[model samples]
Target: MTSFEELGLSAATLKAIAELGYEEPTPIQARTIRRMLDGADVIAQAQTGTGKTAAFALPIIERLDTRSHHPQALVLTPTRELAVQVAEAFQAYGKYHQIAILPVYGGQPIERQLRALSRGVQVVVGTPGRLLDHIRRGTLALDQVRTVVLDEADEMLDMGFIEDIEAILQETPSERQTALFSATMPQPIVDLARRYLRDPERIIVQTEQMTVPQIRQVYYEVGGRDKFEVLARVLDYESPSSAIIFCRTKSEVDALGQRLTARAFPAETLHGDMTQVQRDRVMARFRSGQAELLVATDVAARGLDVEHVSHVINYDIPLDPEIYVHRIGRTGRAGRSGTAITLVTPRERRLLKLIERSTGAPIQRLRVPTIADVIARRRESFKETLRETIAAGGLEPYVSIAEDLGEEYSPTDLAAAAFKLLLGEPPEDAEDLLAEQEPDTTEEEGGRRPRRRREQSFGPERGMTRLYLDVGRNDGVRPADIVGAIANEANIPGRAVGAIELFEHFSFVEVPSNLAERVVRALKRTTIRGRPIAPSLARPRRATGGARSGERR
Candidate 1:
């Protein structure tokens, strides 16, 4: 409930904040701003979308003496994308003051950074590697830096930037005020704070829960190759007003964005490789509703806060379960309901379970929509658009033309013609949108799959081959446990693992034929649900009701 004006910010800082349309300080901002202004070293823990940037930026900018500019404040981020974002925030908040901020990061010409450094900027925001490079070359002087901030400290440590961070910090003045912010305080981060930070005031923001209850979480089991086709169908069926699709890598973001664009989806890519200006323009388009979707990696979308986003799609299931929460948190803001959909390959279902446990929410299993469903949704959407237009009474001029056409042809025929023009050509075939469904196997008592009685060999399936495992339902084993062990131990894509049938004494799993041996070898030494599992090739049995090798069961 605190206002920025009450945070003891300078008049210039207050004016700039007001111009930026920020009326109140967020929890992190309210707690850390005043202490930072008081020149205290603070260690703050907060989530990604919280207003941590303004918390540190406002105080650092307010304390800057623009007249003696030589990097008075330095901010180190884990990625180049974050560096640019933080630098831009500083500039926007300090617009009324005569302050200059420079962002130095990789992918940009070092000479440009050197030129900016020679001009003596008041603030320098940079990534660890490039900042350390500047430090080693004696280009970026830290003698005048009175405040040093480490943003997303945990991410930097995860990326193996601890040594570079230490090297850069060692070059700074010993008396400089230090602030570290991270979502979680891991042991290494704690050790770093203990050794370097001088009696830091710890501010721990206790999160009620990792996920927003208003967000509807759903997952669709899909194969790796069929993912894009399924994603296209989902978008068409849902038709989100505005959405952000989270991908795992920058290359994936770019490729998927381009593909979506080719398919007539208004998508823009955001990642670390983009220039600062490109990133700004992409964000502008997204915020203005010109772009319907934003495809981005986790690092690029870290501090993004877009309230109008109605949907969030996780194109790639995150290896780290905690990241799932952050990806879905991009939506369902300001008490508005939103949808979060994740496409999980069969093997990745185990990862989804971990995320559900972390977020304390049950994610519903969603069936993939067929091509007919997309077409039906489109028709309904078009009808609604026509109804709204008719209600608005904007057809007065068009009525005469319609009447003339009606004289030559029946009204129904003319209307049908118009509909075709408006809706374009509907795809005739629905096979592309329809995902292949696995056959339902009957379960015995206590919900266990009935075991096959006869000795049979593993069945063959299209793009899959069945393997036999020595453990089954009686061994406290489930499909996900088996899939997780194979996927993790073999270092293979979860999508490569297919249908799994758990019986009382043993189980059968379908995997890509090329990877069957690898999976078997990996599972031999792996444990599922604490029980050691040894997988081997199973011969096809000529049992009376045995599932065919090529078909999913």
Candidate 2:
């Protein structure tokens, strides 16, 4: 419950936090920021959605030396996705410092990043493997890096990045302050901390302090493809005075907005890519009651103050638990009761468990809104409208016309006709929306990885190319990390990935043969399993398999 202004941050940082609309620090933010500011190397055990990014990021930003271009801090993340997110946090928190925060990872154009590096940035956030690559290539200079953060350290160790991470740490100043944050500290992570972090202060930010007292947290387990229909059904059934739908990526926000528009919901999309003017217009519509639903990404949805919002639908579950708190916190505000429903794929069940454990609140499972439910909601809404209209008493001129119709029809028939005219025919659908719901089977699919499974598809008329990956299934690497990385960043269809095999040290996938080089080159530029991709041909399938066949003959 500590106020951010009372945390001894610089006036500039406090101003930025206020501008970002955060008046108080979450428990993790409050405890970690104070400890880190005191120059104590710290180990924090907290879940993802617990505002850990800002917990670490704000302290780093507050301490950064703006005049020097040399790296003052290096944050090593386990995945390119996380690297980007962390770097973004630095930029947001350090806005008042006029400091530069750069995200360098595999999959991005190295030359462009190198040019930026030469120009100078204050902080470098990277996957360990890519950071090591830059250190070796002389593209990055970290002689002044005073602070090092190993985020999601356990996942990094699982992915075989311990050696790479240790090497990166060695390159930084020995006098540096290091902070480590992880959900679970396995032996390797603990060992890494012991060797690198100097007399670290331990902080455990329990979720016990906070509760969503006015919010009803629920979820409907369903497949990704059926989410839109289910979302529509939920909207029709809930009939909130106003609502917001949270999406993970900008593309999702845009696509869902389009889909909702097509289905005739008064909705609009907002994301980082939109111009300020466009963002303004969307907010204007939502606030002025012209739009009923606001579909947005986390960045765009931050600090939204629409008080009438009765529900927040996480169209996609956030990557971390703190983000879940933030998303649902959008509703149940201003002393009003609110509802939050997350749509979960079965594979994310573990993630949900983690969230529940961290928050100490069990999320109730919800049945998908039925088609009959949608109709009932609409009928009720019309009834309310009818009551309001009668109260206003402005239909004197139309009374005789109704009477003329009443001559041809009985009271019941006339009333039914009037109901049809006003609210359309009541949809008599009896099917449960849950009937079509499919648990996201990607995680269980024998071949496809989770993130990449259903988000996209590649068509036929393609031959498969087998390529090597430096890390494998042993690293807790799922198909989704690979697929999400490829599809979103490489423009590769998620389905384009064919057979995959995860070995202890490496992995391989069958992609379109022609796209092999592109995939390898792209993957090399980003981190998967927390390090630079060391993609190289271990053995050509033709040569290895052909040689084996000849030996057998």
Candidate 3:
């Protein structure tokens, strides 16, 4: 179907889809939604981020009897994270239908769920365990359920929730329209579907169609701490008109969003933790060009159909290859060319190769943009702006000022000074730009020494304060681990972290003086290398002549 209008959806639903920026139905959505609305059992073999949620959700909402409010639909997921995400999708798509949707998961308080169930929700999206618990407590009734959806069925089978799923299905009416969605339909899933669904309509979205060919894929190998810096440089070089930056976790999204905003990138964040209103506001800002970059987690960015996105950046490479495909699929839509850039750490190169192998496409590796490259790009952009302004023929006032200065200086010199004034100072620390270059090896006593090694200093930088941690090299902690923990837990930018010095039983890390205490407090409640940490202000240590005993280089 070219448009949702052809799907026979109500006007209200079409309005909601329009406001959500959905231009057309995805392949999976196009094939599955019609059968679902026709009350046919469907078995769709599609991966996550394939618009599968909407494929089932839209039909469920259209067929729901909201007046009864006795759980007309039940959507089962393997993880609470996905349960919440799917529930949110139902809410977003069904908002016009005026139906109540409840998401029940184990980690949340049961009493709250009990009360919500008592209040009556038309749809219940939940993990099998919690849904079973509610069913056993006699608080949830599935007799009125007209639709049942098993989302990520293979994952549920992998998680050993197959029995719970069977039990939940047994509780629902056997005549209900059943829909099963899975990335891979293993034998168990197939058997379960055969036994539960009645003559299901099968739809398999091919692997070749999962990735968009219009996207130019590339990756840059960067250290974890240097990722933020590399990303900033890449953004400067690419200068995408609009971009969505995918982070692995919500905490990463928030931290990266803050860092991008601090650097004047005009970024917004979307994650599961934000309220619906907050998400709406963020999406509005992103779609309207008020925000140029959207730092988001996978679940939060799903079902988003904004067509103007010129780039999709994987700030943190996804662990799952399918997820990588989905992340990049956000761009290169509506017949527009797009770019997908990823930052890979040394340890993550294996994962990058795995993704390439799975996608059957080679991801070109490119060097991180140097400070000089960014400066040159800035100069070129300034020249383009100058040309445009001159073409507009509104330079009379500026010409008079140039004429006044022409007597004192040459025109070329005057233009050069103007260019310098407009383009601010170039980045300091040219040495840092060479950090990603292949290290030169030299013969040493042990074996070989890297010529371009990161400096190890115990003292903090001028604006930073040093903090000590109880766990270190002995606890199997690496510099990247330290940076990730601090950035994720403290909500600080990884680039803000200063020098890190690792010792046998301890380590010292630096943060901005203003955030030192906050980092310490946040670290106190967190763990590194599976061991709890005791973080505090670093105490003075005696100066040593050479490398400290048991210190890691």
Query: Among these predicted structures, which one has the highest TM-score?
Result: 2
* TM-score, per-candidate, Cα-based: 0.46, 0.54, 0.48
lDDT of 3 at 88: 70
Q: What is the lDDT of residue 186 in candidate 3?
A: 92
lDDT of each: 0.77, 0.74, 0.78
> Evaluated with lDDT, which candidate comes out highest?
3
Structure candidate 3, residue pairs in collision: none
TM-score for candidate 2, please give it: 0.54
What value of lDDT does candidate 1 attain over all alpha carbons? 0.77
Estimate the Cα RMSD of every predicted model relative to the unseen true structure: 20.3, 17.6, 15.1
lDDT of 3 by residue, 152-227 (tens): 9998998999999999999998899999999998999999999999999999997553454667999887665556
- The 10-residue segment of model 1 with minimum total lDDT is 448-457
RMSD of 3: 15.1
> CA shift at 131, candidate 2, in angstroms?
1.6
Candidate 1 at residue 389, lDDT? Answer: 87
After superposition, which runs of candidate 2 have C-alpha atoms over 4 Å from their true positions? Answer: 204-210, 213-238, 242-309, 313-338, 341-357, 360-553
